[model samples]
Target: MKSYHLIKKKKNYNHKFLNTTFCDKDKIRQAFPFTALIGQTNMKLALILNVIDPRIGGVMSMGDRGTGKSTVVRSLVDLLPEIQVVNEDPFNSHPNNFDLMSQNVKELKKKGDKIYTNFIKTPMVDLPLGATEDRVCGTIDIEKALLDGTKAFEPGLLAKANRGILYVDEVNLLDDHLVDILLDSAAGGWNTVEREGVSIVHPARFILIGSGNPEEGELRPQLLDRFGMHVRIKTIKDPISRVKIVERRSQFDRFASNFLIEYQYLQDFLKNRIINARGSLKEIKIDYQYKVNIAELCSNLNIDGLRGDIVTNRAVKAFVALNSRKSVIDKDIFTVISLSLIHRLKKNPLESIDSNQNIIKTFKSIFGYS
Candidate 1:
């Protein structure tokens, strides 16, 4: 088993894979397996759906720390199949996916050469809290210009994360300015750079996954709204369940070298399910009743905007697709509504609130959830 650590320098760092082959075997073993994690079904489901449908904005995991928040994210890479990426493309955009690599194509055409295509696996890049604007957004290559008198644009994390996951651990602690950058890029699915006499734009679309302890600080409402799904995870309280979690984790760490091989089938199963679900998602139909129910729920809960309704609808559709269901049902709607709406419902400090339970009960009564 090997230990994996992200080594960062001024504007560059070693690119290492947690589960991939590296000289240090112990680092890879240090990563907890996603399959061994217990409970937190909502968190797991949110992550799974986001992988299947990156269109669902991204997932936010808010809870106390040391509850395996980061572990679940790292382990997800093991579950996802490697994605094809363009070789030598700074942004790592898949050459085959022209829609996502349009900007790259334009740049290549300007250079008077036909762009060739190559494939690479999807990567999960972490955005550390202390990262600077230059590091995150890329900066001019002064040395390259000094040596060749030609401007060179260095790609940033956003570029590297293209067509992959951009994970921000303890995201609430990140600077507001950085958050704004992320929000703008994520909203548009592209990052445009026009500073330092360099104008460059490339595909920056990615699945934004964030985790933090809400007790430390509440995420800004504006940023909070950006997340398509919010899941609250807490340490399992049942002694038996807790013990089982510890045992499984211990066994995985003890046999880190063989852990992935043993669970390779299970990982492939989950990956295939996600891939198939994405295709099937387009076929799931939402009835007028479901729409009305969603709208009514939002209105009843006094949710701020139409985004909630949209996310709730998409989540229900994805949930049904995951289960291979052809149509959205009352139960599916109820479950999504609960998962998507509960975290957003505002609480009144003056009044004692049990809104979560109340909403669930009301939804059950309205939708006849058994």
Candidate 2:
């Protein structure tokens, strides 16, 4: 059987990978299957939860290099369903969206020529270390203004990345000013650009994914709290697991097609689960006792604000949805509470204990081991 991870089947094509790229790109970039990664279970779970529900806030992964952090984030691009966008529109605007789409798009639709659409692969763009404000927020088209005597807006990374993932590597090292912009857009789901007294606003709702080594630098508390969940990664400690990791990478390097074929079934299973979970999220049950349990845990941990309780609710629900279940249970909350609340807890100056350990202790105190 053909590997679904490698190329787009005829059934799923829309002929607009980048909307204006030379041709399809699914064949060019070969991402490792999400189901095939070794270890780092918590980190992988955090990524999957965010994919299932972006409102849980995007996840942050901080750990050592060569732990498959970037690989995991990029692999997620493969598992997402294609998004609909107005054809020939650079911003990838949703249909019938005049307020956020370009004026050209609005005019084209007004002419009633049966506006076409393309179901393109969702984007997963990188936020480079040296990206400028205009580069991230877009800028005014100076040459168009000077020559055509008309104003044009140049879409940037954020524009290309609407309804997609904005991954920032070494996130702790990103400039603080840019961090502020990320926080604002992440919270508001809109990116407004003002330059030369001209302003532009468009949909910028994307999951903010960042991976870095904390030893390089510390993430600001303000920004840290903004992440829906955070997890630490480490190299495999078991000798067999390490050897298997090497074997898998070697197989992928030497025979990518075969490697993908080996895991295509597993990948398809995960992809379907995510798709179904999204459709059923509204109907998934949320018990009040579960809410009290999450609130109690966050409160006892001294995690400030209601963000913890809020994120925990979303995460737990997604967790249940991921398991193909329709309701929340005490054990379901246990599975996600640490990931949701650990990053939100206030840190003590002299405490070396990790937040997950503290969360486990609290879990035992409240619900006892499960």
Candidate 3:
């Protein structure tokens, strides 16, 4: 018989290896997988849709402490796909979205050869409550300006979070100045600076994510309206499910190394699903009636301004996207309204007498959902 090594057919060597650097290893290490999180279904759903379509502003989770509010927010990292960005760009600018590039950078791009793209893991920059205004909005390098007669705009958290997620823990406690800066940047999707005689503006578009306990303090109305979606998370009361959570956590901790190895495939599988959902969002359609219903609900609820309508529409679109649907439907609109509008209601002292019942009654009458 011929030798096996010589007789075996040779495999083709032309296939290219996929650049896996987009896979955010650091994010994964920092956050637990969404699938691994137990309970908080509504919170998880809102977050899922937001990640699938960042235009839904971003999700705000408010609830009791240790109720997995923060846990769910952090877990989002594992569900996102990697992104392509310009090499050496501090803002993580997409090589294709040149419209958002700065004037100087745009000119540079015209003169330079074709801009090269590099794969980077999607980012989720956390904005701590204690951060200062200067740190958040960025400061100029005075020394460099004086010595070299050149102005260098140091990027802030918003710049770093471009085309990615900006998570704020205990957002209600953030300083007023910082809140104003965040709100301004979030509203226009760009940050304009006119300080130290150095004028600069750059794209600061990012998904604004926040989680906090209501007991600490209430978020400002102006800032609250900026969020696209709001979710309330409560402690799991079921004995069995609670037990399972403990057991699962214990099992993972006991076999940390082996557990991660075994679950890597599962994590990647979820990431792929999210990527597919994002692609599906663009193809999904919405009917005029759905828009009318959204408007009616907001109007009846006495929601201020047109932001609620916009957020409601975006939330429904995101929900449909997550379902991989071709068009928006009544059910999608209703579900989104419940999650996005409940926390946003202007509290009435009279309504507070039986808030839950009154809210449910109104919802049933309007949307006819049980």
Candidate 4:
């Protein structure tokens, strides 16, 4: 079934992005299949897990340049299931996500005329480095105020990205204050704008995705902990994998249309699988033993709070669903431990050990060598 909802607006909707002035039309409209990406096993896994369960929290992918970090992030757009939205809603607010609806939409509904609706690609709005505060959080509609003396709100990037991905490339360079606003919205699932005597609130729930070079700078610890999973990518060293990546890009450049046609089936298959997985997610089983295992693993790591434990459990479920499995097992926990707890681990610069290795050691100690 489609999730549908109502929205109130002054202007008749135009689906062409009123924002996203920075996006390339071709890049935003079409992308290489997620299945086609080469290497970066952990990075791919981290991305897919977030898609499966946004409640797992958002993903942070940090690495050196030329590791396909941005490519991997953009290609995810191709595989997302279509979302039902009120016709022309700048926010892409869901038809049934009434909690996020405007007060006007609520009042208009009392008349009992069914609100019109349509399905569209779930957006992935890029938070450009130079975007002004008004562009990010919206501002009072100056035209409305001047022409008609009407106080109205103009939806901005946060509104447009509702129920979608807010991707920040080179996120390390983003202003700390802007990052703080995103952190608040990602945590609480709403954005409230109070400016020019205009107060408008809308749901800002989205899967936050950020990629940056670690050498440039690290995210402040307060912000880093907000991300549920952190993944690092390395340049592909295997000659065969490198060759495959180059060949794929060459083929794409040489015959863009043909390349897309060749992968269309694979893309559709993945899309349908995700749709089905989402439908059946609540039915997918997680064992009581698995719950205990997640808790014990986090405990052994001395990770603060239950976010680590909760995110791990959600990631394991997503992994099972993505693999078409109905239930989770011990091996699932082992696969997710590093992704869940790597960033949460306290760094001991003097200890001279990899946090990832420590994650594995903990897994082995808890579950025994297999």
Candidate 5:
């Protein structure tokens, strides 16, 4: 068995073992398996739900350093189902969906040209902290357009991230303007760039994943609420669990090939679940009463906007689909309601109640939990 070493042998106990590099599908197999992660169940659940249904918007994870936040996100790459894209298209244009294809590809298809496509690993694009607006949103080359009599548009991170995941580490530290741009594109599923009075538009649909430490600086409530789900991750306090995590990391480091093989079955199982869930999402049903209860729960919590209710519904359905179920159950809502509604609550610095606990309490009151 061939080995895939993600980290150097030179030991730094405190360093993050997994590097969050965007690579080809073959290299993605070397990542730490998503199923092998030790803890942070909420974070994992949120990520999986988003994967099942990208319309759940995206997930924001805030936690302590070295809590495997980035590792978890990158590991998700291994489970991502490959997508068919037009050959040589920077936007990763979908083969059949005109809405997802670039303008040139659309014209080619309209002209009865055979649009060549190949299946490739779904993209996982990282937005660097130092990236400029043009780099992220792409730029239009006015000089080329003037000389060649064409719209010379350059694709950016958002273009590459179409039909994929866009992850930003330390997102709280990112520029507010850039953060606004990201959120806007995420919500609208399109990014439009204007340069020198020339404009270009492309599909920017992707699951926007952002992770950060709360201590660094919090995202403005308005911005945070835009994310469909928020998970709070804490460092593991249990001594035994900590030991298990360390042992697993050490084993993988020493015997990378064997470790991957050990978890190969679980990885495949998860990948298949994701693919099946996506295909069956339209078949999953949620009861009308559950929607009412969800609305009531959000109302009692004083969550701003209908986004909370909408995200909660989508997340619960995605959770059901992930379990290979045909309908939503009360317990399914319980599993995801907190993730969807907690961040939408109005900040009350004087309030002593924990946000998660508050949501749970409200849920029990409205939904009749013991």
Candidate 6:
């Protein structure tokens, strides 16, 4: 009966489609499929665009608890396309991109050595609340270096997260110092650990995704501004959508394998779409006028720095690429401008306007959104 229903439900669905089991039976319970996540479109777009172009910086998702922030972020483990990296490399070094390769791997490549490469799921690292700096930034074995004259360094979350995603839940509750460290590594694209004259530097580039409940606490504007995009997730209030979300979760919990099998097609389509977007992101062009409009939008909003303008441009390009379009359109700018600039606007406690509304109004006025 199950097989009959699976076959008859979607005419285009073929059992042989997607040979690889997207959700392994054993690990099926580990994460929910990304395609199955419903609502929270802004959060999903921000996350997807970051994957499409890591140079868009990272995403800051602030919303109510139980809004699927953590679940959606973790589900990215399955949604993301595989990345090719040097096999067994601690930093997840890219096979040919020297900028993303570790020094050791780069040296081996320079020596004309055969570098073994493997395709692995893009990593999604969870930064625990109680994690220490050393654990997050890696520690160097100074004693070993002093006695054996060899530098022995241990890689940390930042190293493992290279070329992947680093997710911090309840980010507002995390220590400010640690947040600073994360922002620094995220902005610089490299992490350096030094101990007693011993030092090691490695690529730490990753999509830094941080989520928190606004009711818990607000992140400092300085730290928040560093994020490339910010999205606010609200609990689903519509009766039908709420019921659908609940039913889907219950079905996923009860029939993990069948549920996964059912969603595999959508997952495959989204993963491939993301892969294509990444490939064509560089080809998606933005006109000079659009660039000026982006800058003008930021300027009119009184955004603190150029980061808003830069991120807005990058995000629009990613959105265009995600849709397989070669040129950004007015709708693309209208879609991405708020996510890229809303959090950067200076707070006006005395002002009556809502931040989101204010940004949208300014965007429509400047971009002629009508």
lDDT of 3: 0.76
Q: TM-scores for all candidates?
A: 0.86, 0.87, 0.87, 0.88, 0.92, 0.92
C-alpha lDDT (0 to 100) for residue 99 of candidate 2 = 49
| Number of clashing residue pairs, candidate 6 | 0
Candidate 3 deviates by what RMSD? 7.8
Model 1, residue 123: distance off in Å is: 1.0
Model 2 per-residue lDDT tens digits across residues 1-370: 4777446664245455355343323433588888989888998899888888888889889998888899889888778988888887777777776645655677677887678888998778899999999899999887777789777888888888887889999999999999889878877888888766667777787899998998899898878999999988887789999999899988887777778888899988888989898887877879887777778888889888999989999998888888889978778888888888877888898888877888998987877564
Candidate 3 regions exceeding 4 Å error are 1-30, 352-360, 368-370
For candidate 1, the 10 contiguous residues with the lowest summed lDDT are 1-10
TM-score of 2: 0.87
lDDT of each: 0.79, 0.83, 0.76, 0.82, 0.91, 0.90
Candidate 3 lDDT over 178-208, as tens digits, reads 8778777876789877676777788888888
Deviation in angstroms for 196 in model 2? 2.4
The deviation in Å at residue 302 for candidate 4 is 1.8
- Compared with the true structure, the alpha-carbon lDDT of candidate 5 equals 0.91
Please report how far candidate 4 places residue 133 from its true position, in Å.
2.1
> What are the per-residue Cα lDDT tens digits for candidate 5 across 83-167?
9999999999998998898888999989999989999999999999999999999999999988897898889999999999999
Candidate 1 structure quality by residue, lDDT tens digits, 107-168: 67567776666656677899999999878887777677768987688888998888889999
TM-score of 4: 0.88
Candidate 6 root-mean-square deviation in Å: 7.7
Candidate 3 vs. true structure, TM-score: 0.87
Q: Model 4, stretches more than 4 Å misplaced?
A: 1-29, 141-150
